[model samples]
Target: MFQPWLATLLIWIPTLVTAGDPAETPWISLKPENHNGKHIVFVTGDEEYRSEEGMPQLAKILSKHHGFHCTVLFSIDAENGCIDPGVLDNIPGLKALDDADLLVLFTRFRNLPDEQMKHIADFVESGKPVIGLRTSTHAFDIPNDRKYHRWSFRNDQWKDGFGRQIMGETWIAHHGGHGWQSTSGIIPADMKQHPIVRGINDGEIWDPSDVYTVRLPLPDGCIPVVMGRVLSGMNPEDGPCEPEERDGKTFDKNNPIMPLAWVRELKGSSGKTQRVFSTTMGASQAFTREGSRRLLVQACYWCLGMEEKIDGKGNVSIVGKFKPTSFGFNSHTKNVRPKDLLD
Candidate 1:
């Protein structure tokens, strides 16, 4: 039997209940707004693992503030502290690859059923834009399956999993002390003029709580967007203990301490091209302020080819904490500031 939420979502179909709007109850908001022709979908629900945060709020922000037509899909079952709210089973009015402009995914150590996975595969095959956060790369789990292996960076089913191959890294432990650190001396000079990076500068940083360092190479055509110097004395989530002697050391001895955030154009086997923007870090509360927020908003606009529209509006700025609350969401106030890419 289908769960009540799943059934309700399905019944509502193309008509979705706006999270906070009573008037738009049980109906998807399809009204023509600034994002009239744009469609963005957010897949969230990994709460059972580390923390259930970010994804849902990201969708809401894009929808309400940026005027993006957004849909958020949660997992059906909550397993191992990971929530798999079973959204795929409902289907609602959702169809595969129906003019979707972007697919934003954030899942943990959970595998989607074959049918659900197929829907995602079909969507990606459509050659649209994709943005993944944190555990999204290795979000699934299915050993002894070639299809699942391809999504992982490391062969060990217990280790690298799917995230490494797609987003370029699995979740390694944080090197910097808990909380956030301001990034310095890492912004790409060449990309300084790029609108997506406009207003971002040295010493400006987003507080994504903890950032992951990629241990593998990204797909071809990937461009580095930001790089950071990793502080030393960090341990993998389930790896060996932190070195007692390395407590104050600010650099990793086993690996290069430089971490990167990037964008890429991927060409799949089907000859379709997809645009992707990945960052090792961008979920911290600090990111919702100053240059970091501006960079993210610009990146979204650029990905949607709406940079021109945003540019005509002058500078763009957003303020708030990007961190998710107990309800797994956050909010931001947008303010257009001047574009100063070189800054």
Candidate 2:
């Protein structure tokens, strides 16, 4: 009864399941040498700003240099099982959040299915620390009929949804000139001592990404740590944006800079307070600068309540080869799977 064709069919079954199924897409894992005992799960899916590239490198830095176990999940192209930010609905491996100490979210306008989305919802309810990067403010674009519709960025029923309720703000506007104007991080005089900015100095952190507008005086209990000075050009040394006249009023873009990074203590459904850190700066190109990388690493420490370990001059070096693609729509590297990033 051992037919030759049956053996061939059995051999192909495993390959078919592995290659055709997006839900079985592999996630990148980085084990810590020093072992800090904390696990950080980075969920990256954005059509622009290359969150897929940036988050993996951040995970490496945290894992190799800082002693934390890191897992990076990507949106998978269901057709070929490759990483595709445009594939907004299928970000597998979110169940890793169940045991994660911190969740680094950098998605934009995703509408994941209920089962996958439930993991994120449950994580939030557990009152765990969350680090939200650029575009994360408008992370979900779920339909009203869905169970997780309240997580949508513009859900009126939930009053601006996840971004507003958890991170303290939703997408407002591009405060700075997109692409043309860049951002220079400025630690406020009073906030210089904050643990999140302990290793970063005023004007040291510069990101090619422009500043995003936030409704200010930010929501209650939220503290702005770093202010963003809109620059005239996309260089770190560029001068501040010039004043413009609008409706008989002169508007100075940097006279009152926007908050580049902020922190909040949010009460979760579990009635436990969770640390939330939100930053409008995390473009792939931004991590090329040491100051920008340091800011994020420091923020991770602060989020974990390990502020005592943050050194102003600590290591936040790039773990491996990283030449990030510039930010643009449909700009992600095609056909690349998560396993391809390990090299």
Candidate 3:
């Protein structure tokens, strides 16, 4: 039912840009450019859970080709898909989370409420810098509240609440069902120089959801960059299935394998360091290839360090087009260029 003039023409079609027209626009407003700092990006999801997938076109392509200063918090009411109403009084104050440097969780099974889950656990313990995509590691589930019952990894107080010490692990299950493969081709040779895997090569097979398997054990000095190979499936809300086995063929038993992406460090017992970057797989729109949208826009520009602001001079277009309202929920608007939606 969301069609407020296509969400106000997809929030003003990024803000048209046609000087020489290289074509890679989408930054409607939030000024502050020349950015080497000030990264603020908070985009929640669950547009009716899976209403055709697009998550505000990946938050308008990370605030228009990565200059990032975005703020798109939306749970859209969340119901049978598990509640999430406006993440704590519709967060976005505190001078915009103290001019947030980064935080891009993409919700899916949220159920917030306990004073908005302690204001999202005190805004991820205030350490800052996070980028969990795909079901945001079981987002947030309040079985009956009880302070949010460990957030969910099947439950058992998994990570001891607050989204497993801030997204180290929570929702495990994906034995590779969507398609494609090849992960972590063993890149940890001192992180291949890091900087988010420089350019990222070795095998390369982006665009294909569902890939997890890092049980739990990251947030300490966390830094595992990328590790692949385990893919099976099963997490479509985990229900109705059959066929199982692990080291002996016969998969599909509701697919339950793991580890699709990683990069962490959240020490914080008060020490404070935070900086996470998980990825069970981009919340499907059918993989949006281009190496899965440049591996989720280079893992959100290396968890907000900006990774030199990536613009290698090619491929970065994602203009606008969301359409999917049958009540399922999907209306990111549709401004191809109506004067860039009246910018």
Candidate that scores best on lDDT: 2
Tell me the spans in candidate 3 whose CA falls farther than 4 Å from its real position: 1-56, 61-68, 71-100, 103-128, 132-174, 178-208, 216-240, 245-265, 268-271, 275-277, 283-319, 323-343
lDDT of 1 at 268: 68
lDDT of all predictions: 0.50, 0.87, 0.50
Considering TM-score, which of the candidate structures 1 and 3 is the better prediction for this target? 1
Cα lDDT tens digits for candidate 3, 188-275: 5677667665555533424234455555555565566655443232222232334558689886522332345678776675677667
User: Which residues of candidate 1, in runs, are more than 4 Å off?
Assistant: 1-32, 48-53, 77-98, 145-149, 156-164, 171-173, 177-185, 216-219, 229-257, 282-287, 309-323, 326-343
lDDT of 1 by residue, 271-308 (tens): 87666766655453433455555555666776666667
State the displacement of the C-alpha of residue 214, model 3, in Å, after optimal TM-score superposition: 2.3
- Where is model 2 poorest over a 10-residue stretch in terms of lDDT? 12-21
Structural similarity to truth (TM-score) of each candidate:
0.65, 0.92, 0.31
Each prediction's RMSD over C-alphas, in Å, is: 11.1, 7.9, 19.8
lDDT of 2 by residue, 1-343 (tens): 8999999767433311222333455687776546689989999999999999999888878877777888899998777889899988999889989999999999999999999999999998889899999899999999999999999999888989889988889999999999999999999899988887886877789889899999889999899999999999999999899999989999998767799999999876788889999999888999998889999898899889999988677788886679998898988999888877765
- The number of the candidate with the highest TM-score is 2
Q: For candidate 3, give the lDDT.
A: 0.50
